[model samples]
Target: MEVMEIIKDAFVFPSKDMKTLLIYVLLSLVAAGFSFFGTVVYVLGFVNPECFMWGGMAVIISLLIGWVMYGYLISVIKSGIEQSDEVPGFEWWENFITGFNNFIVTIVYFVIPAFITVIVGYMTNVYGNAMIVAQEIYLQATYSYMGSSSAIAFDAIYQALVNLLFSLTITITVAVVVFVIFSFLQTMAEARLANTGSLSEALNVFEAAKDIRRIGIGKVIILVLLVIIIVAVIEMIFSALFSIIPILSILSIIIAPYLAFFAQRAVGLLYSDIA
Candidate 1:
């Protein structure tokens, strides 16, 4: 139940069956390969529009594979919630459905934050320009009143630029805060969805809040921080080790599923205490 123990157990959970882990890695490779293929086609398609269709197909295939990967992560969380010691077996259709459910849950959770971010962005990029126009107008009036031709109004332009910079800084800060808060909530929501097999259950903010309360906000934060730190360190190691061999470097993608599995398992373990 301790945060550290949960993290350690989560890390170990992925490797409990190397065969299952390899399946995850192989799926990741397929997804990555298709994604890469799509990118290349898109780039080449810029010169030959006919190639775009192939790129589109690649993208669609990649998305399906990615959905499977995501769904499997949900299963990991479910397994953790159930306190199951064994790895989950793959059910392709079920995984796809779960993955789609997760996508819907994710969109519902973040829609408001995304909308707010867009509004702030519009205000900063569009309405924020009004200040510059007002500044220019003020400068023109001042020049006319002085009985002289209007100049570039360098000082006014400078002040407007400074105001835009200030607005930009504020916008970025708000976006960051919104993303973090919603992302935290979404994580809890995903765990709930995984355990209950109900989309509505996951979307119930009040229910998720109850779980958070039961789990202790401090413990959740600690779990998140530890997982992030561990993933970062592991990623760095993978990058270093893989870079040693150019062709073998692509093997680093294998770690992606491992890290994802570990993190979700941690979330599941956190819920097991209450769920």
Candidate 2:
């Protein structure tokens, strides 16, 4: 199928089996609630030490729930790709296992980029600290000298600022590249795992890269950008509509899983062509 057709199918895919879709939405909402609650608890713990224990536990539980939901969604996308007319139903154990496997795949694929990010972040931090210290020293000198060492202080401050800006620019650029590369591979990995139901197949980087090549990296980029744009537009529309009624706004939770399904369906269809 062409990209446009795939995009068209995604919007309608969920309605083909409303029952299955609703079940997914319900489960997804529960999972999202757990994740959100965990985040809130964790943040609160930082503000108040007494909440640490409960917050830690919530974080773990929420993470597990999220993993399982991710796995189930991948399975659904897999089913959609394999059999266009079929909608996969809830299978707790199976979905959890699949999601766990995918989680592992993600960690492994992410390690390199994560490491790079850490290094860049460390450098950024170092530059940032140096800048702070220089500013402090410059301030002290200005106060002590009453303009005698003003030029020196100004130069020091200027140098620190330049170094910090340079470090920050590099960090941001590298981070964006890493994110884009990993995101592309991650999608391919998910599709491979879902289609083959084999962890090994999903982790086969060489094969995945080849498939991506066949699909044309440029095309993949375009497809991803289009999907993002379409989803964002849908979200804006829903948010606007929901804003009218405070109570009805709660229904916004449904949009996450719904858009997730739509994007995955679009991806599945795109992968179907090359798979």
Compare the candidates by TM-score and give the number of the best one: 1
lDDT of 1 at 27: 89
**Model 1 TM-score on a 0 to 1 scale:** 0.85
Give a tens-digit lDDT track for model 1, residues 34-76: 9999989977898999779999899899999888877888999
Model 2 over residues 1-275: C-alpha lDDT tens digits?
A: 77787778887777777787677777667766766787788788888986777777777777777777888789767865774667677787888889899998899789867888879879778556566867767696767678455566666677777777777788878988987787788889899999998999988877888878988887787888999999999889878878876677777766777788888887787788677
RMSD (Å) of each candidate, 1 decimal: 4.0, 3.3
Model 2 is weakest, by summed lDDT over 10 consecutive residues, at 147-156
lDDT of each: 0.85, 0.79
Task: Predict model 2's lDDT versus the native.
Answer: 0.79
| Model 2 TM-score (2 dp) | 0.83
Q: Can you give the TM-score per candidate against the true fold?
A: 0.85, 0.83
